[model samples]
Target chain A: MELTAPDRHLIAALEGGLPLVARPYRELARGAGLDEAEVIDRLAAMVDGGLIKRLGVIVRHRELGYEANAMVVWDIADARVDDVGDRFGAFDFVTLCYRRPRRLPAWPYNLFCMIHGRQRQAVLARIDELGRVPGAAGAPREVLFSVRRFKQRGATRLGTAAAAEAAP
Target chain B: MTTFEKRLLDEFQRGFPLVERPFAAIADDLGVTEAEIIETLGRLRDEGMVSRVGAVFDPGAIGASTLAAMAVPPGRLDEVTALVNGFDEVNHNYEREHRINVWFVVTAPHRARLDAVIAEIGERTGLEVLDLPMQEAYHLDLGFPLQWN
Candidate 1:
């Protein structure tokens, strides 16, 4: 996407996260040298253009008492992955579900989902229940528990200067 | 949890206002002053309950990204992990309890650059990298109910 100077400035301001104030756009506008309405308009436009996804609060699952979390990988039959993924994703406990390419002779799982709970046993019990679900029944799966988080951050914004240089 | 905090968590997971004064709109909906709403949000962030009040961009929408894993020897875990994190493209790194102990998401401005970074990580660490690119996301939106017990 071709970003104008104000667009770049707006993104730069947002990259640090929205300001905590009664008038966040006013704060952003001050930093970006744009009008408060322009800040809102540009952000709304970016959301529409897929440059920005939904503007919402990013909660810390572990801190919120969801201590036991597992990334479950399923090796379902290739033909049935899409159907199975959809069914699994609909479950309230499943936070994330996706289909990924499996690397042969090393990684054998293609479908992945994340489940979180207050206790390890509770998470396991939920996984067992998931196993009995129609589409997931009898599918080979492995659970990888997160031991530690090394880093977690929002997406990196490509500076407009660099983006402009890359553009034709 | 305070009623104000509860309301903030419940109501603002998604669909934040897109208007001239979003906090004013939120304050009106939640029946609180705009200043109070902003203070609570600030406290939520400072307490590590909230990461950000911003957009979570779609993966691979603004850049190329892939899930990569490495099986590092237990003794060399720190060394290899530091090597991987040295790259600016690496984000969301974690140590999982599995043979493939280290996993991370690498994102770059383009696919070719992303591939090159993955290859370079393999060369630097001397560990086979399993590059798993997401084919489809069944649940693209990640906000879920946060139950505090």
Candidate 2:
């Protein structure tokens, strides 16, 4: 679905996030040149259409004292990848789960899940718990803990100044 | 953290009210005045604990995105990092503990735009860039409860 100009305006208004006012969407509607109802309707449709993956508060794990962010990759059987992925997703500790193509002879991980904890050992302990999940049991995996974050932000999106310069 | 702040963060990660007076609705539930709710959120944003109180778009839905990695020699890590981070398309760059040390996510409005950015990075760094696009993403709505152990 192609995004319209108004849609872009709404997205632009959302770049920094919702205003800290009671009627934030009204403020957004004003900036986007749409009424409050239309603004809410468009966003609702967008959410239903899967364009908006998540609609809520965005937290910074590091600032919240959950410093250990480990991307745990697993080499699960191809046939059971989704099943195992779902199983991994069930764990409260598994923050993000995905299935990606493996770069053969170099990288063998196809199932990746992220575990965030306040301590490295705590993250590891959760990973151990994750290992017991059905097909994930006894699976070969690797943990790539982030040493330093050079930059961390949400997706670079349309209508943002950054995206304008980056895309063009 | 105050108990109220902890509850607010834990409970409101997702399922944010999309109504016009969202903060008011939250205030009603949290037993605080609307102004207090808004003020606390403002303070959280200033402290960097709350990045935003808004929608998180599907990167590929609104545009093109990929997870790319590079194996930079330790001697030139800083230069390579700065070069990669310079691009607006490149968000969430991290140094992971592996031979493929540098990892980042690049998102753009089009596949060509994303490709060009990745290609340019490889050319400038003179290293083979691994373009690992996400094939599928699975999500679970766990509000990341603050484990106060």
Candidate 3:
């Protein structure tokens, strides 16, 4: 969906994040030069339009003691990847499941899922259980544990010009 | 965690109320004042327990993005990482235990710009960039339960 000027302003105001206060829209409205009702309506519309995935809290998993995190990649048959991905994504522990192109001769895994656990053993056991499941049984896979998080931030949007305008 | 923190993490991670006064609505449901709810969230954010209270946009929805990885030599890991992270598009960068040690996500306003950034990284780092754009997202929810042991 095409973002209007107001939508861009709203996104800019929200780039940092929603304020930790009652009537956040009121605060956002002041920045966007829109009324509180307009801010609420536009945000709701954005959510409905799929531009905004969800309006919620972003919990830091590591700080919460989910120390073991692994990005599991599978080499499922091209024909079966979709079915298998759907099944794997249904698991409560599978936080992210997606299909990406495989760079052959180097990277042969296309299907990827992220699993988080309290310990490495827990993550490994869950991966083992996942392999034994019906859809993904015997699927060739590899688990890459995250050794360090160099940088992690929310996605950048609107563009450099708009982003610069949003900066204080 | 205290009961308030626990409740905030559990209930507010997803399905947050989209209203003019969302905090007030949340306060009414949880039997707390709006000010108290706001204070708790502020503290949670300041403590780095929560990243933000906002929308998690779908990747490539408004901007183009791809997951790129590089096999940096062990010795030059730090230097190469600095080069990769120098770009604004490189948002999520991680060190994974594999031959392809460095993985990062690149995002731009358009597909062409995204490609240009990836090419620039390859030129600057002299590393073969493995650009794996998301073909399909089976499940994309970022919110998950925070289980404590």
Top model by TM-score, which number?
Answer: 3
Please list the C-alpha lDDT of all candidates, in the order they appear.
0.80, 0.83, 0.83
Please give the TM-score for the first chain of candidate 3: 0.87
- Against the true structure, candidate 2 has what lDDT? 0.83
- Evaluate fnat for each of the predicted models and list the values in order: 0.71, 0.81, 0.83
* A49-91 per-residue lDDT for model 2 (tens digits): 8777667788888888878889898999999999998888877
> How far does residue B23 in candidate 1 sit from its true spot (Å)?
2.6
Tell me which residue pairs clash in candidate 2.
none
lDDT of 3: 0.83
DockQ of each: 0.65, 0.67, 0.67
lDDT, candidate 1, at B57: 69
Please give, as one word, the docking class of candidate 3.
medium
Descending-lDDT candidate ranking: 3, 2, 1
> What tens digits encode model 2's per-residue C-alpha lDDT throughout B52-121?
8877776556667888989999999999999999998887899998898999989877888889999999
Backbone clash pairs for candidate 3 read none
What DockQ number belongs to candidate 2?
Answer: 0.67
By lDDT, the best candidate is 3
